[model samples]
Target: MVRSATTAEFRADLHAWLDVHEAELAPTYRGMGTLDEQIAQMQRVKAILYEADWMRYGWPERVGGLGGAAALRTELGASLAARDLMDPGHFSLVEVLAPTLIDFATPALAAEVVPSLLNGSEMWCQGFSEPETGSDLSSLRCRAVAEGDPSTATQWIINGQKVWTSLAHFSDRCVLLTRTGPPDSKHLGITAFFVDMDTPGITVRPIEMINGVREFAEVFFDDVVVSTDRILGSVNGGWAVAMSILPFERSSCFWQRIAYLYQRLQALTRLSEPTDRNAEIIGNAFLELHALRTRSRSTQHRLAAGATLGAETSIDKVLVAAGEHAVYNAARRLLHNTITLDDTVHGEQWRTEYLYSRSATIYGGTAEIQRNIIARRLLNLGDER
Candidate 1:
């Protein structure tokens, strides 16, 4: 059974716990740590929080959770982001993928696998993106065919490729989507799976980003065999799972990221010595962050109230991209020559963040796609596609 707590009560309890455990939960990465180190730090935090039961709240008992309101989990993630205890990007993936597993996976499968993820014993990646199917994911061509006797246990043979699979090299498993029907089948014929990353015929090659970080990878599956139990949802009904994961990614993930961005914007303000001319720029950036926070809070409440978030979440995505770019642009503006030429730790940090900020528009659906969603779905302008 699920438990409920008033917002004030939950906040007071959570804050007291954080205060007592701050030292243990703090990120231990030294200056300029790689993505691997960041991920390791995230795992340490997750392990500690899970053991302490904070990580296990807001999840179902079937998945080894205490079964509280989902808002508690989102609040914990947002708190971690605010405190700089973890990378919100890596942390958001769990929010995005785990619920789908719980909702669609068999009870036994969810119970067995969800705890591994919640406690940080394993990492998982979403294998939705392909070389050709970035935003048009319904048209993905990664193939998986069932071959065997109809009565006996069936095994699926998978083939094709996935690109920009974040943290694939480090993931123990991948929630993969594949084409199960003809090319024109599109959304109808797609299927999803939870496959072990080490399965035979699977290969992962990390892709280096412009910031010289290999945070994503290209994954190739050639005749990979998976049991029927590995299927996430009904055969050829995987699009439902894929579609369901998006709201969590867009809203829950957005809340945590907004918290992180707000912290960074606060830090920028404190560290910056604003000129009269740049005051407007800084103010504009701060306003954007505030607007994003407000918008995201409403979305979070809607989620907590059990409302189904749909294409309208593209608004949050758009706000997030704008907020990120504005703050990073403010950093460049404030730091000026120091950001452009200095190689000091602070300067490099700023530089790396600035470069990474460029991708805010691209990841999780591009800005163009987001605007189209808002125009059509939210504003009812017209059908976009």
Candidate 2:
């Protein structure tokens, strides 16, 4: 499993491996169990893949990885999602936070922590959004001040709140952003930290989603003290850190999502009654899904080729939201009243997913925001304001 293998070979071998281990890897409950169960299933799958070295193939050798094309990791995730083994959105979070830590966190810190993350021994959350700042991250109010000599501060005290932090209550650590410069400095004032969740002054309150899943939380940091060693990059350089991770959040996370959308489309086609309208709707969904996949594949290739991802990735975010919406829309239309009225397992599954899809335009940055980034940065247009 550690040896060099093409993505194709990786996929084929993984499928065979999954075939042999399907009984153990499959979810114990039906129709997307409780958030706790989903988290457990994800961790269980990650631990197994890590033990087999499949999870480490695409990572750098310095961080307990086998060192190969990153696509190996994406392919592994896609295969898992296609088979309905896990929720692609949360599982793909590894692609978002892990690389940022590896790049910015001190070598000792990354070496000490990343393997546990990849192996599912720990969970981490991004702490950027605040009660007053959701997508307008530069306006965030969380503040962290060094507690000792400015040049060689040993500790920093953090105080403020973060909202809509996914998996916060369940996370073992947080990649936190804080205001470190003058209040008016905006993005340039921010600093990032790697804080332990059990640190004495932290509190978490879960927020249940419209679908009844308590997947996000509001976190309070009251006089939280963090070691200087936890600083994730240069002081007052967190905006860059935040920007660096967006590519992964917008692009890498969608690799598995694209697969999940395709899987849902397939399920919809099979479950719904066949008719001209059904065929047309399903076919249209497939078209959108294909567009998303094509764009995702290009983004993955760019990542593997060591390209610097930027505003171009906003397009991926746009496609992810649109593609997911199209698929679930078809599910709602084709399944007719089943999703709304039927109390069966499949009905609940479709209903929950359909509801979740409605948020596609909002999370991971909004569709309107993505369009603004596309227009301003990518197209050289003036700010919309």
List CA RMSD, all candidates. 2.1, 1.3
**Per-residue lDDT of candidate 2, residues 1-385 (tens digit):** 4364688887778888899999999999998887899999999999998998888988999999998887888888888998999999889878889989999999989999999999999999999898889778999889999997746999999999999999998899999999998988999899999999999999999999998789899999999999999999999999989988876776667988888889889988998778898999999999998999899889978877888888888899899898999999998888869888988888888888999999999988889999999999999889666
What is the TM-score of each predicted model, taking all chains together?
0.95, 0.97
TM-score of 2: 0.97
Off by over 4 Å in 1: 1-4, 149-153
Q: Cα lDDT of all candidates, in order? A: 0.88, 0.89
How much is the lDDT of residue 375 in candidate 2? 91
Best by lDDT: 2
**lDDT, residue 88, candidate 2:** 92
lDDT of 1 at 125: 99
